[model samples]
Target chain A: MSARDTILARVRDAALARPEAATNREAQVAERMTVGPKGIIPHQGQATGPQKLRQFLEKLEANDTTVTRVSSEDEIAHAVARELRKRNLPAAIRMGEDPMFHAQDWGSLDVSRGPGRLEEPVTLSRAQFAIAETGTLVLTSGPDNPVTLTFLGETHFVVLRTEDLRSGFEDMWGDFRKRGLDPRTVNMVSGPSRSADIGQVLQLGAHGPVALHLFMVG
Target chain B: MSGHVPTSSAFKSNSQEALVNRNLQAALRGSRGNFIAKRAAARANVPEFDDIRDQARDMKNHVLANLDLYLEAYEKKVTEAGGHVHWAETAEDARRIVLDICRKSNAKTVNKGKTMISEECGINDHLAENGIKPVETDLGEYIIQLRGEIPSHIIAPAVHVTVPEIEEAFRKHHAHLPPDRDLSELASLQAEARSELRAKYFEAEVGITGANMLIAETGQSVIVTNEGNGDLSQSLPKVHIVMASLEKIVPTLEDSATLLRLLARSATGQEMSVYTTFSSGPKRSEDPDGPEEYHVVLLDNGRSNMIGTEFEEMLRCIRCGACMNHCPVYQSVGGHAYGWVYPGPMGAVLTPSLIGVEEGGQLPNASTFCGRCEAVCPMRIPLPKMMRSWREREFEKNLTPSATRYGLGVWAWAAQRPWAYRLAARIANRSLGITGKSKFSKLPLAGGWTKFRDFPAPQGGTFMDQWKAGKR
Candidate 1:
């Protein structure tokens, strides 16, 4: 016995072949199974830099978010048009068109373009700062770039630059093999835009972007 | 025009009012922030990704302990490569063997290429309730099949619709003849969904896919894509089925290139996902854009009762939404709030054992045991000890919650007395800190743990009042 106890004795013989249809919450989750545990939640080993992952996305947006650093991708696209004009919202900026991110410094970053359709909410700049250990992003997809202007937006304003982060995923896959880069798609969005399909109900911009506004520059 | 919206047989008739619905908490809040940061960026990119998830769970329990001698060496390498290997064992004998091979290859129309076992055999509402048009030619499932909806995200299936609701679902499903369009033109919504799905890929006689790894030394299947629509739904079809399920086999092209370098870096943090292919069968004899006829069905549906079981390390899942991208309850409830067709933490433990833990067991009590989906499961599938064995089969079948069976039956009878559970948590923490003015929001029958969130207030003293005020 064991391919975990024959997958929990075939879920306790299909919850004892259905006793008033199984729920004494799935025969107490069929006598509480456990087999080899540990999965993930460690990365707080620290390494956020794009000015501490843009002051932890402006102190999780609007919370004493302090940061003092600037180098340029056009001054992090004028600090993302001054944080989407405090919050009036409407911008479509899209430029990676590649020259190895315009061969560094002011690579281009006024992102606003959006729509890969999970119900529509836009934000599309793939870099300025990336690597909170490995939520990794530093996109470059080219042809004056139109990969849904960085995955059809719903609040996806990335711009990272604490000397472009990278401590993991083989240190930004050795900067995509020392800058040949454009193998076309690179969308490392860390949060927001979600779905559990309807019965597990926990929806947010369903197909993409419910929130992920980063802006780190150094 | 069967635009694919079907999954409602309601999980097949009320899997408990579709797991207590309020639009499944808006599809579990867009599947809890991309499976909690894609299993915290695949557990900071392999710190021996939990000992390479126990050697890919002993290579999927050594290919499900020799599943019929690796399905007769994957049907003798798909009939020595000309291809055509079928086997159903149910979803009505794999939709009556793909509607008798699309009515003996006459097939009116079909394009699809994102086959989660043709969304667990509902097969575009059984080939559009049998009339047959079936399109979903994947571009986030052709904008959630032109806004009819479902498939909210599993390697990005319209990850919860946004972009001015995909520019009002392409101005209400692209109402012909443009008018100042340019919603960042996306090649004019990919040339009006390729002139309405390039006539179902050249009046398709048949083309349907969904393999993402199958091999067993040679019967090849693999599919990882960025859109060459699984190679134009298997080289502009004359018939190509494929479906898949028996824990998507493995055993060589160097064990599926070590599961395709851990499947496009635990899916979409990317090292390679722009079309991965590896087809190997129908199109040989000096090929030239293949498929004159190639079948491959394979289903098992319940996966041979998870071959030996602790829920068979959820058949070493490679779905890699990295446990609903790092579940904080699949990021505030998403994937149609886990009603079924497998959503987050591998559909809360394979939909209470494939649609039945009393018909979709309260999806392993939604969850907060939060071990960030067994630290990013490249195949490490522990998932908070399988959501505490579905809360120990919902507390040994009394289906719990009579105020959680009177609060875990008076905290398991004052947890077998540590001085009557520390004098009933020190007189319920000094009557909830003198009627919670120290604020835990509000309590009593713990208003379902302070409604949506915020439940802090206990530090005024305890771990036995900070261990007897730090050892007196």
Candidate 2:
């Protein structure tokens, strides 16, 4: 017999040794997977309105991610430019084919649209949603938001909209399901890369971006 | 590379050597209270931490009770997502399957993220034997790989290596750089490794990573990392192979989220790790970049036997390293003393089950039964209880030391008869009280105990005599 079969049979016998009534195990699993019960959503992640936005920024900064707020989408380009200027980086950035970013007037900035390449100084990607609980940014993989740009940039700059922020993973999953979108990859990035491997001292920017700057626009 | 034989039976000798090694002692001392303090502060920061832990444990129990069904569901979803799953009954099978994939992909070099399963299977040695280079990209794993040694700790692989040793290794291996370069600060060493590994990431043909949690809902393998090496490892190479044990599967994404909430806090005291990437399958056609082929090797070396047994709760372990972090015995000896891929309380129970009791029995007996491991375990697993079970199994198999068995036999026989037990206890106590002279630097039968510390003399008569005199 195949390893899969033999192993599964062993699991079945061992798991059912006491015989807890085999009541259509497949159906039970199917139902649970479909419904996906939410287990113990933290009270910290269940706020709304300005309170939610404030919690999101606090948690984001606590994780070593800096955030800047713009009153309108029109100010996103200027904010991005200002971040680059403050860090003394060149006026160059890479991004994906997301229409949200293309609509912005990137005045005097050199912006390239595609996946990430080696030695990308700075890259911009519009976050699909920001989770308030852990201050996580959910970026889906597609031509619109190439996943490579998320990890390849030396300094990653993300544009998040205040309206797109959710309280927890449950609401974010709801947004994903309602949109009927299934990307090959969903990256939940909390901050810039870091490692404590060298004598257990945390050094930022191990393999991914060293500096992660966020522009929260409304 | 040093040939790593299972020296588990020599745990006593290994621990003694570890205690005396100056470099190892310094390294272990530097990191002794950092994890404990961080975990305590992280837990204190969250009000509902214990509630979440309970929920996580219940979810795992539900999945384990229906493991066959969950595995079937997880396999179906992976196939639906355009990925292939391979089941391996043993470590050899896992290595063979990975090698076959590498051959078919014509992989010359493979980049690897930090995966304890790979360490368990000895994949690097096997791959190198087949003439394929496996580059460990995680900073800790990379350092240990260069030294040709297994990881001392599961999460912190090179926790036993000191700073000077790392600098020396980097200097010897990276000889292409200028010899006079300054490598004094820790930052400089980190910078050198970062730049060195960057080139290898783009050149490798295959990338291998381990899964923290595998969701049966979407057929996704999720990995969490503080550094972005796991992301780079999976995204850069043309083929991505995930080495996972079958017990990693969970019923749904919500279940995964619950466990994720507790995992990082318990492991490193972080609200969330820097990167938590969920790779469902190979890149979609419309996607710009990702691995073209994705394969998952679901390894079940001895996990199948663990299920539905006294050791079944061991599967609930999430490899958080909390048990070892708070373990006094582990804190003293460090991880290498366990003489296996795993260490500490978890390893004491698991090593005996994975490797046979005869070979791994000494590990179970190494514990102090202080119950700190079970107290800090997020999964609420009875780690001390399981280790005791392994000792029982050893005694039943007659693999225990003959002297210990004889002593236990005498104690048991005397205890069954109350009169003989009282008489023997009084005589022994009185004789010891007279001869001990307050403390014993040496003892007749307890050389092991006396060799480390002194044994105190008995105060007076036995408990029965004192009770009869109204002392009770």
Candidate 2: tens digits of C-alpha lDDT, residues B213-308: 899888999999988999899998999999999999988777878888889999999988999988998999988889999999999999999998
Chain A only: give the TM-score of model 2.
0.94
lDDT of 1 by residue, B232-269 (tens): 66666777888887678876544554565467677655
Classify candidate 1 by CAPRI docking class.
incorrect
Candidate 2's error at B407, in angstroms? 2.0
Calculate DockQ per candidate and list them.
Answer: 0.01, 0.75
lDDT string for model 2 (A1-218, tens) is 99999999999888778467356767766776774446788887677888888889899888889989899998988889999999999999999988888898999999999988878999999898889989999999889988889998999999888888999888887787787878888899999999999898888989899989889887
TM-score of each: 0.31, 0.96
Best by DockQ: 2
Considering only N, C-alpha and C atoms within 3 Å, which residue pairs clash in candidate 2?
none
Q: By TM-score, how accurate is candidate 1? A: 0.31
Q: What fraction of the real A-B contacts shows up in model 2?
A: 0.78
